[model samples]
Target: MFKPIKSLAFATLGLAIAAPVMAEEVNLYSYRQPELLKPLTDAFEAETGIDVNVAYLSKGMVERLTAEGKRSPADLVLTVDISRLSAVVEAGLTQPVQSDVLTANVPAAYHDPDGQWWGLTTRARVVYASKDRVKPGEVTTYEDLADPKWKGRICTRSGTHAYNVALTAAVIHHLGEDGAKQWLEGVKANLARKPQGNDRAQVKAIWAGECDIAIGNTYYMGKMLEDPEQKAWADSVNIVFPVFEGGGAHVNISGVALTKSAPNKENALKLMEFLTSPKAQQIYAEANHEYPIAPGSEPGELVKSWGSFTADDVNLMELAKLRPAALRIIEEVDFDG
Candidate 1:
């Protein structure tokens, strides 16, 4: 049962021809652009003969979903952050899914305990250190980023951005609120410049000799390497996995959930299950340069070359819970100013 297609953002993937009979389809509201998800959706459509329709959303997904309520054509939601996924669940926009296939493919630490959402891929929040300026093993822990030795030698994106806020929330989970505050203050003191720019911009700063190291996600290296203009920036740095004092490296995910008002529940479930399978996981992860969470699905050659580290065992939903506190501390410190 197809509803009125309101805008160009909601377009059906051109993977397979529509069935002559009642065409089966699953609508997705995704933060990812349609082209980015084409590989995965194309594969799913080819395998199951279910058309995948995508609505690309930049922000305000919760409000949009709420406005549509039970009449929404959206069956699935694909978003990048744990906080976003948790927000949907908290807003009563998502329903818990029960499936042996999902549970077996995704690890317990990567999913909501109540099955509200499941992680598809993870990206480690890692350090990008200058190959010529920063020595190997010079920085081995997130705690060390606050050291005076690094004073006036670090660059990062705005503290209030979702990625940095998520990292701060992880720090809060590892350290207490007071400890996290001190860490934020120390990091602020060491900043080479005011917090500005996205993660890639930080790397460009390092390449331009503005800073010796920067906080960024691992996948950006792959992204930069592929870009003609940014390749030099990618070549100038080495990926480093910094750990918490007593924990493993910090990691975050891009995940998916079933919307509460799913019009095509069965087709959505089929697509969800197929997405977690090894083949789809590989396609999805490779396309986005992220780490696949499913068993038997390994990262691409470029990603594997970055090396590996044990991911911090803290359940991601806890990090989502700490986001507010993290944002409050960042505001208190005026890290961007």
Candidate 2:
């Protein structure tokens, strides 16, 4: 269920503008598409008997929250990527939540040190290699993507895209700014064409022989396999987890946070805890094709079949902090030009 922005009542001078409804409900402002969250939200609603109302925002989530201030009815904000999560926290739109369940389910590296946001699931930034054109062991490290040998065989989305920027930020963490800049330049010089299209489009290019390999999130392979029109694109490639030299694979997360202006705090907390529960985590893995973060929780069978790699040890908050620098380096290299 989704609530229209206009349907919410504002509180003034600590007084409600309209009488409150009796039924328990939690309002969510989410950047994640609603369909991806339906199963998890439905399960939470069913088990707790709490109605879930979602307002999907494509952009300006921070701006809207800032404008609403104390009048905002949103109890929680759900989004993907650490950068967006950090932005909301930086804006002070979210409040820190301390819970034994959240702390235990999410590894320290995947959540905020101060508990501003909690990671629910993670997805790796991996390579999509053509099964026919590329051999296994040919591409093993993030550094190898810049090799001269594969100069004309690579494809990617825009350098400034959040996914790529996060990957660049991870590179910055591993090798200072100077090293990361050079690597970006190397990768730019290796592009088969101007960085254009989404991650799945890169896979389509592989099927069409436009390129041999491309960088994309691991879950996209699952999505592609599910689409009849895109199944061939998925079947044409192998999922490859590349490591940052001396580090493991780079990954990002889908996370949730409690808003500062929560109208139904207790119910919102219940939903947050439910999101990290083993049952909800399993639904997230099976329904959305993401890797669950809960203790003893495992990826759906399809995800498990793709194989696994140790996640890079650097905390995601560090990557969020470096995003600006990463964008600067990407611009300096004229990666899309």
Candidate 3:
């Protein structure tokens, strides 16, 4: 009876002051070029009203993040390939993200077993061969490229490149270490030219008649089709799905995860959910010519034009774990030597 209403108001004010303020911004460290990822980011901002500030870098995003430590401004990390993502996890840079949406959208095989990161989209490591030079159905599997007949006719990117390394790891998983090493040596014997440039370069080499066959991601063909100078490069070759009779096609992914010290945890999670939603998944497929991790999302016309194939069911995480061994085999074979 003695306490006035003003006293209660003062106590409530102290409680409010002690409560933490929710963050409104999410900082992203992405290895992808900003322009390529702008659509997704813009959509995320528009949908969630969360401002996304991105730092785009082609290299050393991991080192940069490591340097920042707990003081890092980053709330999320987006990058391509399992090796790079695993590196972030190994560095203790990412925290376990528990999200039912992500778990339901991305298969267990395509994500970290510990919920550290999730694959957003997948790219098949398929075959591209000169239409005139290599007959259809003649070369049908990854192992076929190692055939002596293809000697001095295959072109590929450098083995040190993540794509090649992942592909090598897949081979290891399929055929065991010794068998994979033998296959690597055989593939090396078949190189038309020294490994150089990215996957697209291998296709261009095919067009120039420098090689009769090459291994590359499927999306690169879509990119080439949209490019004028590279259109001919796309035209000169035909895509072949290398279903490993028993195993499936080799595949890799671009994935996302929340940082360990997320300043905007809720917003970071919201972005992850939105990105994996059906609509956002479609955007990823259409814009990047990649297969959506979410099931049943149709790929763009360009991707549809490429047709469909079974992806290698071997868990991609195994590839990340086997990377060092695969890299060693690459060196032993002198992939660039």
Candidate 4:
């Protein structure tokens, strides 16, 4: 009788057609620029039927997340610098991830002990020297930057910036407070300017012959080279991978964490696992010129051509914990002056 009606099946079919299935969606609060993450997200979306919605925040991400509280839509957080990652975790804005995939892909050194955040890629803070002025093997270590011989020649951004602070924290972690203070003072004496500009500006300063050497992240070399206007700035310097006196080159990371209020926890975890995979790491490295955190993941040819060096094994958590002390040291050293 129902089949004879020809209506029951049609009604059911119409109802099914009226309601469409939605793709799984995960929201992101990222300090990372949208362009920087699009390729990865696009790849992720293609592989998994999940949708990535990114709300890029240049600053105040923590404040916004805290304001949103439990009702927040943020499923994940991506940021550069370990200090930012540690701050998010310490602020209770993140949740610990207990995924085997994440644990397996990321080295213990690259992730939080509490599993709150994990590094995806790293960038070394290295020296950029004028090809005409600086000689090979002339500056081999971070300590060399402080030597009086380079006085009035070295350029850098404000010591208070997260990048420099992290490095300062590392110095404190390895050399002790007093030792770090001395090192900060020594490097401060070597500055060419009042520590005014960004890393790119430091390179530009070298190209302008305003300084013989500059300190910046290794990744900037690639970024500058890719920009038509900045290519000349990049071409002016020799990328040097400098290490700590007895340790390796100081490196920082671009990392990720799970939001505490993730509505789509499963999808978020999936995204987290995917990001640390070798494939994603390679994509990120090639896109951003960062060194992949996944071991044995090779960087792009451009990055490879920059040469390689030993990276310091000092736990980044230690550096994050020491950042406040490091900032104080920067102020005490009057490094900005």
Candidate 1 stretches with Cα past 4 Å from truth are: 1-23
lDDT per prediction?
A: 0.89, 0.89, 0.83, 0.85
Off by over 4 Å in 4: 1-23
lDDT of 3 by residue, 1-337 (tens): 1022111111222121211334676667788776777788778878877776666767887787777677666778999998999999988889998889888888888888889998899999889989889998988899998899999999999988998898888888888899999999999999998999898999999999999999999999989999999999999999998976588888899999899878778989998888888889998888999999787787888888888888888777788999999999999988898
Instruction: State the lDDT of candidate 4 residue by residue for 221-289, as single tens digits.
Output: 889998999999999999998888779989999999998888788889899998999999999999999
Report the number of backbone clashes for model 3: 0
Clashes of each: 0, 0, 0, 0
In candidate 1, what are the lDDT values of residues 116-227, reduced to their tens digit? 9999999999999999999999999999999999999999999998989999999999999999999999999999999888999999999999999999999889889999
**Alpha-carbon deviation at 196 in model 3, angstroms:** 1.2
Instruction: Summing lDDT over every window of 10 consecutive residues in candidate 3, give the lowest-scoring window.
Output: 1-10
- What ranking of all candidate models by lDDT puts the best one first? 2, 1, 4, 3
Q: Which stretches of candidate 3 lie over 4 Å from their true place?
A: 1-22
Cα deviation in Å at residue 53, candidate 3?
1.0
Query: Candidate 4 clashing pairs?
Result: none
Better of 2 and 4 by TM-score: 2
* C-alpha lDDT of residue 81 in model 1: 81
TM-score of predicted structure 4: 0.92
Q: What is candidate 4's CA lDDT for residue 71?
A: 68
